[model samples]
Target: MLGNDLPPPTEVINMYKLNQIGLMRIYEPNHEALKALRGSGINVLVGVRNDELQQLASTESAAEDWVAAYIRPYWPQVNFRYIAVGNEVIPGEVARYVLPAMQNLHNAWSSGVLNSIEQIKVSTAVAMSVLGESYPPSAATFSQDTAAYMVPIARYLNSIGAPLLVNVYPYFTYVENPSDVSLPYALFASESAVVIDDGLSYYNLFDAMVDAVYASLEKAGAPQVRVVVSETGWPSGGNGNVTTPSTAQKYNSNLIRHVLSSHGTPRRLGKSVET
Candidate 1:
């Protein structure tokens, strides 16, 4: 769902009206929306905007006040499920804020005022760029620079029982090397046979990408951490060469079918993914 820079109250009422029409989830930074839609049944995922992270990290009191003022009052009324501390913090210019934002979020979560802290989850989303190399299946790994930052973050997330959220896009891989990367393979349909560790076979790119993340986590010594794909979708419209509607429909349809079929990965055969 799209959000705005508007203050909490206005955005909350606006979202409530939008929710009535079928937009169930909204991403926002304001707490007033939580209060406005209290008991309204709308799901909200709050964000810690980058600009505010410096302030939030500077002092524990700031984090406490922000949560108490924006989140505490709306408790039990608003369905606050996730607190995303930073967006794409791993591989971009905002890497500096990743640690601090995470620390502040933990402080806020530990504060007893929120009431729903145990039920609510705190996490950060990362872009696919965090992977240093993703091709050839086996060579895929996290960048040394990213690992320098992600290693400790992964440990902390594991310590808090938060899953590592990654945004993967096989479409970009196909677009970048369409000649070698088959569309069906990227779409999670056809079998593109490739053996990894000279034994395990890979049929689709999605699993390959996932396994790459799994490998990174293993290398980081946070092997038990669960990885979640926070975002993955085909664009419905784009330029003639890449974003044509026909290609979009084909990709999306195939993806939906694959997901609904409940086909587990080679590494996780017969084990259905719940989400």
Candidate 2:
């Protein structure tokens, strides 16, 4: 779910079976495993390496070439559902590549790599660092440094009908500020009072975090763009101080139930989120 670089095919298959994971994220597209796992009903999200981003962004030819070599050959055989142009290219040195990478992915799709341009979808995953300030639920907003880039990025993603992918973890938030953040609130274990804004009440941290992103998008003038949670989970094991098996189960189980029970965030009530 985190790293795409995996071991050999046999080992990867065994690991997938061992963990009962139906979905996997791979860095480089692999044709052999795609063929081998065809009937296994596994979903894979592939990526274009960072080094290739600049080339892919700047030239339509490069994207077409990359897709033809890395994607088309394995097409129909591999259940390639999503193609992430680049990973976490925001709010850091890599931020410069975000816009170009997005443009390239869009150009690739427009180039008609697939017989039907409507068949394949592309998106880029972003880290929470993209947010300028995300705290106290209502105060969360995109940072100025990221905003200049995010605004255009969000617009391009919207133009291409791609969801904005983000990785959020309330566990990390709570651990970072235990003195201020309540555990039950972070884990969605609390039935306590909710945080209300503009007459909307947030019942959990997950929804609040999502709404924060939604708000940021609205502020960026891309309110129609959908937000997808590319990653969110609790680790079962970590340094004794931060994590343990018991807490991990409690956190992840409850989070799963919370997501399953909801169709969309308060900001986009009743609307279906790509997730």
Predicted structure with the largest TM-score when compared to the true one = 2
Instruction: List where candidate 2 sits over 4 angstroms from the true fold.
Output: 1-22, 136-139, 271-275
Instruction: Supply candidate 1's per-residue lDDT for 152.
Output: 84
Ten contiguous residues minimizing lDDT sum, candidate 2: 111-120
TM-score of each model, in listed order: 0.79, 0.85
Model 1 spans with C-alpha error above 4 angstroms? 1-27, 30-44, 136-138, 191-198, 260-262, 269-275
- lDDT of prediction 2: 0.73
The Cα error of candidate 2 at residue 236, in Å, is 2.7
Worst 10 residues of 1 by lDDT: 21-30
**Cα lDDT tens digits for candidate 2, 1-275:** 24578566767777787877767777666666665666566667787787777777777778777877876676666666678767877766766776776676667656544755445568778877778776544566789878888888888877878788787887777778788778777777888655777777766777778878887887777878888777887777765745778777887887766665655667778755444
Error of 1 at 124 (Å): 1.0
